[model samples]
Target: MQNAITELEELTLNGASRSFLKETAKWCKFLSIMGFIFTGLMLVGSFFIGALYENLPQTQAMPFNVGGMMTGFYLVCGLIYIFPIYYLYQFSVKMKKALISKDNDVLAKAFEMLKSHYKFIGVFTIIILSIYILAAVVGIIGLVASS
Candidate 1:
């Protein structure tokens, strides 16, 4: 029992900073899980959209069937867009919890910064990926039109 108390003290006492890291770790695990689900849905949607585009006629935009499918698909994609946004909110909530608990202010601030940095990079990557996919689609269309 003494050892347990000692360990808990060491865990919380190493610095308020360490506790903040723990909080970030806890929240990031959840955000990462959401990211996984969103990415999977996007991958599946991309395949279906690709197939639909393949069947499209020249001079015709996507048909009602394809557009309808994509409309539903993008709604889920938008949810994916917000999945990481939830991480920002999670960071805010955890920071507040740390403040209310009178824990480490420095570490709490660091945790917020860390999550924001990750979120920024992730959003950038998503944008780049979207552009690449667009380019690929255009390339495929050019090839089909030429052939």
Candidate 2:
């Protein structure tokens, strides 16, 4: 473990690695910007969902407020999506600055942001999968009870 830590401390980016990282940062910035735009669109659309659904004849037959529920669901999704996008954006900006300035602290922070971005995605995936599993189990139970 100590040897691994020592080797990690000694690690340095070669010219090729630096070039690759710079390219990666550019792509990350582009993707993050796109994500932000789409998320903003989703949020904006969420506000209009209720109005749109109300105009539909089918919505009136439903007992519950499907439009309001959909709006809230979309808003929640947009808010949850922002965190990873922001982290990616930060990583891209910090990485570019770090590469240009050769600043170790900035580079470390950039990597930290990248780590955060992936961590958030990983956790979100797990939570969503868990929800799916739980829903499946409940569905099975409901079917069994109905039979």
Candidate 3:
């Protein structure tokens, strides 16, 4: 176990790959910024939904306060999006620092953050797929009933 741990610690990016890592870090930073901006837009849109809902005429009110539901859903999605973006941003920053200083420890930590970013995205994707499958099943049942 100790030998395995030591061998893992020895794993490092080749010097030739430094440029590639730098470019990847740059792209990650850009994408992270865009993600944060989109999350902010989503958060703002959630409030906009609530405001729109409040202004709707009583006659237009949806069957289960769907407007409020939309707002809540948007807010939750924005909040959930924050975690992956933050992890990616941290990875970008740490990766840059690691490359600059040639610090293996920082590089490892950056990779850990990258792993966390992917883990969050993977789990979210699974959840979304499940939702899609459920919706499809429900739609099929509705179609069968209508027939």
The full ranking of all candidates by TM-score, starting with the best, is: 2, 3, 1
RMSD of 2: 2.3
Cα distance off (Å), candidate 3, residue 139: 1.4
Q: lDDT score of model 1?
A: 0.66
By lDDT rank, best first, the candidates go: 2, 3, 1
Candidate 2 segments whose C-alpha is farther than 4 A from its true place: 1-7
Give the clash count for each candidate: 0, 0, 0
Which residue pairs in candidate 2 collide?
none
Model 2 lDDT, full chain set: 0.96
TM-score of each: 0.39, 0.93, 0.85
Q: Candidate 3 — what's its lDDT?
A: 0.92
Those runs of model 3 whose alpha carbons end farther than 4 Å from true positions after fitting are 1-9, 54-61
Model 2 CA lDDT for position 109:
100
The residue pairs in collision within model 1 are none
